[model samples]
Target: MTDPQIERKLIEIMRIINESDRPVGARIIADELRNRGYNLGERAVRYHLRILDERGFTEKHGYTGRSITLKGKDELEEALIGDRLDFVITRIEDLIYRTDYDPVKKQGNVIVNVSYVDKDDFEKTAGLMRGAVDYSISPRVGVFEEDSEDIFVPAGKVGIATVCSITFDGILLRHGIPVKPNFGGILSVENNEPVVFKDLISYRGTSIDPIKIFLMRQSTSVTGLLQSGSGTILANMRSIPQSAVGDASLLFQQLHESDIGGLLAMDNESGNVLGAPVDVGLSGIVVSAGVNALAVVEEYGIDVTTRPVSTIMDYGTMKTL
Candidate 1:
């Protein structure tokens, strides 16, 4: 097998190409290596490029240049997460604290506070909580609609929304209940009835409140690329909801048919898409964030999560937020 260090260098090259948002030549890449203090030669760079092409990480653009493939983007994402992967793996070390009080009912409840990295970390941690907690759990992802005061899901129970921050060590720090709201309420899902503040608490302070708190960690990384502008991309295969699979598949098809030139498929339940096999007639892939569906655009190979806006009608009142 190739040396792991060489693999890392190749991944760095892929990242630079992807970030550039356009094709690049080896001379530029060689110069970049020189600036980084690496004593690599043009021939060495070409060798690595050939290996990447063979592995489907990159492809020749036309005659003289090359660009990143969908597989390249996926590999680069994994590579960038080096060391940071601990943030996700060490989630077990995180903790969620809970307490509750029912002043009006003359009974106390439980409130669970999860300490984690940030909003994304909070969401991933919530997924972990679903498995840890004995009670039934549901996970949802979306931004609060404009003009809406709160995030809501029809017929769903409200739970505590913890504010999370990231430590330099990649630990997720969470601050629980009494979360301040600007216009909308806390991050709890809204039901038909107003999702009152107390609703977000874990327990009503009755008896030793049965509420439980759990924590899961999310890992994020920010790495520089050569020509591509700076941006954020979420990588995971399990986070995709089962209910959204069809939409996700259709979005993949749309992307494959577009000018971006790439393919996408559900790699696993985590919402991560492995590099899809595509004809060599197309360009490379670029993966990024989206809405309800994981979108794979062709030519550019941009993977975006987006729900078909038209699919909104298929949803029932029970599904509306």
Candidate 2:
């Protein structure tokens, strides 16, 4: 048989054994394969099982069923990684809005806002003009200097609003604010980085307090993600709710307030998208925090399953913050 075909059967058998607390026989294996759309028979399965036992991938207990060995587990995980023939692209971004716009020139135009950025602090302050690059935003800088009872607004400064402009559906900002946001670890979903809430940004809806706190935890974990690499994230989730979140920029504002180190979220496809605002065009998503994100999800009685990654919705793309 072809190596790939043999490898496929081996991985499937390993998974069955791993999932089962007790030993499984060849007949059971054949039945399971048939249920999954494979048409292998018990005789064929036994033939392969004999080969597996020879390699120590399967341990046959005389008349009893068979179980997978440690080597089999390693082989399965390796196969999972190798089976990643495709990737879901997620574009990373920062909390942003157009800060540089002439109210006199482009008044009452549509503006877009997002809640995560990949640039460092102060770097975006100067170069974050309109269309600086693919994802950079141009917003007015609002520099404030309090003079006794009076307020002084300077031309450009960090963490301040500078210009006056109208925002439409997408949220064009006169004073655009971008905060430092981050995430760590990748949810191995097929071959793509996972996206939540259509943009990987999460916000409100049903137990928002705890969920917001969870997002903060992962965001702070970005730098410490073990053996992590940089990748661009772009999200495109369906049915983003605007009412749950008011302003998209505020989501990052809270993330900054939480002082998150980086991003560590999404084991795979997630329904929880955190840190979104109302009326910023993008919608809100609820996320959970903790080392076991799935456990947190299950605590709320949400059904979780492991399926082929192709079934998930297209969220957004992302980059290292």
Candidate 3:
């Protein structure tokens, strides 16, 4: 077999063994491989097992079969790293396709960004989030108790879900308007007006969410924006065909009327959106980032772990911030 083919089979074999509760035999591993569409025979599986044993990735249990070792687990994680590249954009596209939100009636499942905060800081976090309502994708927010069944909240931590801006893309798509997400960036704001994107990370390039990266680097001055209207904030850019601009505008207005507002700027007749150049035949659309509220909580020295475009939730369940 070619090196790539052998590597794939070995990875699959290790995965099968890792998932089993007890040591797995070659016959069982071979059967599972076939179930997963790999037609490896028991003998081939045993051969691979010997290789794993030699490499100290697996330990043979006298006649009981074999178990994956700690080394094996680490290797597996490292090997799968390449598969995670561009995962952020893939997740965004998947959520957009899964969205069934109806802005006109404002009653359907919509995308949300999840955050975890210490239970003791929940009230403070909520208040801080309220201060940045103007910069969030929607005023509606969902708070889950530490023991809430709706979402998994870590021990002593509360889960907060915010509306993601991708909901706009989904809404436009429902109306036959296709939208292409461009990037997530830090937008410089002065006097409560957005100036330009100071830095941009294309959605197609990175595995980690750009907003999350910026937050980790302490790159935001959201507190300044909240106090003096001059600081950097998180934002996203999208592109839509020029012909659908009229329809998109009408939908955006309806969305605003429904209490969902994140529209920052759109391309004008000159094909420039807030000083950002747009491609021919397409208009660029910029909107407030969903995680901006979480950024505020972080600025206060409260710990927060954000999952962007994490999951979908009923719009009615969220309470206005």
Order the candidates by TM-score, highest first: 3, 2, 1
Can you give the lDDT of residue 62 in candidate 1? Answer: 74
Sequence-dependent TM-score of model 3: 0.77
Residue-level error in angstroms, candidate 1, position 34: 2.7
lDDT of 2 by residue, 78-168 (tens): 6644342311111111112322323333332222221211123234423322221211112222222322111211112222221110121
- Residues 187-224 of candidate 3 have per-residue lDDT tens digits of 99999999998888878777667777787887888999
Cα RMSD of predicted structure 3: 7.6
Clash count, one per candidate: 52, 76, 0
* For every candidate, C-alpha RMSD to the true structure in Å: 23.4, 22.5, 7.6
lDDT of prediction 3: 0.83
lDDT, candidate 1, at 228: 32
Across 1-321, the per-residue lDDT of candidate 1 in tens digits comes to 888668756865775567454576676666545433345677888888899999998989875578898888887766645433332222212211121222223222211121112333334433443332211111222232212222211111222222111110011012111111101001111221111121121122211111111001111111111113221222111123344445444534442332111121233342222332222222212122111011111112222211111011000111111
Which candidate ranks first by lDDT, i.e. highest?
3
